[model samples]
Target: MKAIRIDEFVRDLATLSPKDVPSPKPKGPRDIGVQITHAALTHVDMLYAQGLHQNNGRHVKPPFILGNEFAGIVTSAPPSSSLRPGTRVFGATLGSFAEHIYADENGLREVPKQWTNAEACAVGASGAISWGSLVSVANLKRGETALILGASGGLGVMAVQIAKALGAKVIAVVGDEEKARMIKSTGADGVVDYHEKDWENKVKAMTEDGQGVHVVYDAIGAVESGLRCLRYRGRLVIVGFAAREGKMENIQANRILLKSAMVHGYRFGEDGRQDPTRTEEVWNGFMDLVVKESIKPIIYKKNYVGLESVSQALIDLGKHTVWGRAIVRINEEAERELKARL
Candidate 1:
C-alpha cells in the first residue's frame, strides 16, 4: 500500500510525498479494514503537514500517515458487524491518504446508494461539524435565522446547507463577491461579503427587524463580529480558526456578556470521542438529511487524482484557493468500480 507519511514536519508542503508502506490490518474485533477509494483534503491536513496544527507533537507525532476523512469498500469486518466485506462505506480515521485503512466500526457508515465514493468521502468531517455545531450545540430551531462565517469553504458550505435544511433562514458571510455568489445557491437566504465595510451590521440588518440572527456559526475566528450579528440570548458555536491562520483568538468577555449570548467551542472529533453515543446520534441525523437529499457535499471543481497530488491539494487548501471540499482519488481501481455501480 502507498501512503502519504509525514516523517518530519516541514515548512513547505511541497516537500511531502507518498511512499510505499505496509497495508493496515484489523488489530481489534471492532476494527474494519477498508480499501480507500477517495479522501477529502482539508485545512487540518495542511496544518498537520507543516507542523502548525495543535495536534502536532501532541495528539499525533511524526512518522504517521496523513488524512482523516475517506470513502472506500470494506475489505474485512468482524462477523458481528453489520458492514460486511464488499460493502461501500465512508467515514473518518487517521491515515486516510492511503490505499488501505482500518477503523473502529463506530467510525464507519454505509455510503448512501445515490452518491459516489468521491462525493461521500467529502462529507464526513464537514457534515459532522455542521450537524454537531448547529443541531447539537447551538440547538438551531426552525423559523430562526443563522449566520455562517467562511460560507464558501468546505465546512462553511456544508454548514450553510445543513442550517437551511433545518428550516432556519441562513445568512452567509464570505470574503468577497465571488464567494458570496458561490454560496448563494447553497440556500442561504442572504449573502454578506465580509470584505464590505460594516459587513457585520449588514448581516444583522438582514434579519427580522434588524434584531440579528438567532445563531452564529463561526468557522473563521470572527468572534467579535460574530457576536455583533447575534440576537439577544443567541448561540455562537466556534468550530475553527481559519481566519486567524490556524491560531487561537482572544474573545472578549464583554461582547459576549453584552449580547447575553452563549458561546460553545465545538470540536467534532473530540466531542465524539468523549461520548460515542452522541457521535452515533449526530451521524444518524446527518444521514437522514443525506437520504432525503436535503444536503450534499459541495465538491471543488478541480479534480485531484492519486496520492501524489495530496501535497498540492493541501497547499491549495492552506492558500484558500480551493472552494468547497477538495477530494483526492486514492485508488483508481476502487474509483472505477464505484463509478461503474453508480
Candidate 2:
C-alpha cells in the first residue's frame, strides 16, 4: 500500500512523500477495509499539519497518513455492517490517505450508482456539515431566510443549495463578482460581495422580513461578524472557522441581549466524546439528502495529483483558491490515474 505522509516539520507541499506502507489489518467484526478511490482535503488538514488544530484527531506527530474524507469501493467488511465486498461504494473515514483504509461500519455510506467518483468524493466532508447544520443544528424552516458567510467555498456552496432546497430564501455572502455569480445560479435570493465596503450593511438592507435574517449560518467564525446580521431572536450556528485564530472568540452580553440571539458552536465529528449518537442521526440524514438530490458539493474539476500536491492544496485553501473542497486522493485507484498512463 502507498500513503501520503510528512516528516520533520516541513509544511511545504513538496515535503509530503508518497511511499509504500504496510497495509492495515481489519480490527474486529465491526471494522471494514476499503479500497480508496479519492480522498478530499479539508481546511482541517492544513491546521493539523501546522499543529494548530484544537481537535483531538491531529494531536499526534506526522509521518502519518493525511486525509479526512474518502470515496471508495468496499473490499472487505465485518458481518455487522450491511456493506458487502466488491460493492461499488463511496464512504468517509478519517486518516484515509492510502490505497486501502479501515472504516467503521457506521462511517460508510453507499454512493448512488450513477454518481461519478469526482462528484461523490467532493461531497463527503462539506456535504455532511451543510446537511447537518441546516436540518440538525438550525432546524431551519421553509420560507425563512438565511445569511451564509463564506458562501462560495466548499461547505458554503453545499449550504446554499441545501437551504434553498429546504425552501428558505438564501442571502449568500461571498468575496467577489465571480463567486457571487456562482451563488446566484444556485437560486440564492441575493448575493453580497463581502469584499465591498459596508458589506454587512448590504445584508442588513436585504433583510425585509423582520429585525434581520431568520438564521445566520456562519462558517467562518471571525469573532464579531455574523451576530450583527441576525434578526431579533435569530439563531447563529457556528459551523466553520477557516478564518479563526488561536483562541475562541468572546461573546458580548450586550449584543446577545439586544438581539435575543443564541450562539451554538457545532463540531461535526460524531465519534469524538461529545456526541456518539450524532453519527447515526447524521448518517441517516446525510443518506436522505443524497437520495433526494437536495444538495451536492460543487467539486472543482481539477485533481491535485500526488502527495506533493497536498501541500499546494492546503496552501490554496488558505489562499482561498480552492473554490469548493478539493480532494487529496492517495489510493491505488488515484495512484493509477496519476502515475499510470490511464
Highest lDDT, which number?
A: 1
Clash-forming residue pairs, model 1: none
**Runs with alpha carbons beyond 4 Å of true place in candidate 1:** 338-342
Query: Candidate 2's error at 169, in angstroms?
Result: 0.5
Candidate 2 TM-score, C-alpha based? 0.89
- Each candidate: how many clashes? 0, 1
lDDT of 1: 0.87
In model 1, state the lDDT of residue 246: 59
- TM-scores, in order shown? 0.96, 0.89
Give the C-alpha miss distance for residue 31 in model 2, angstroms. 1.5
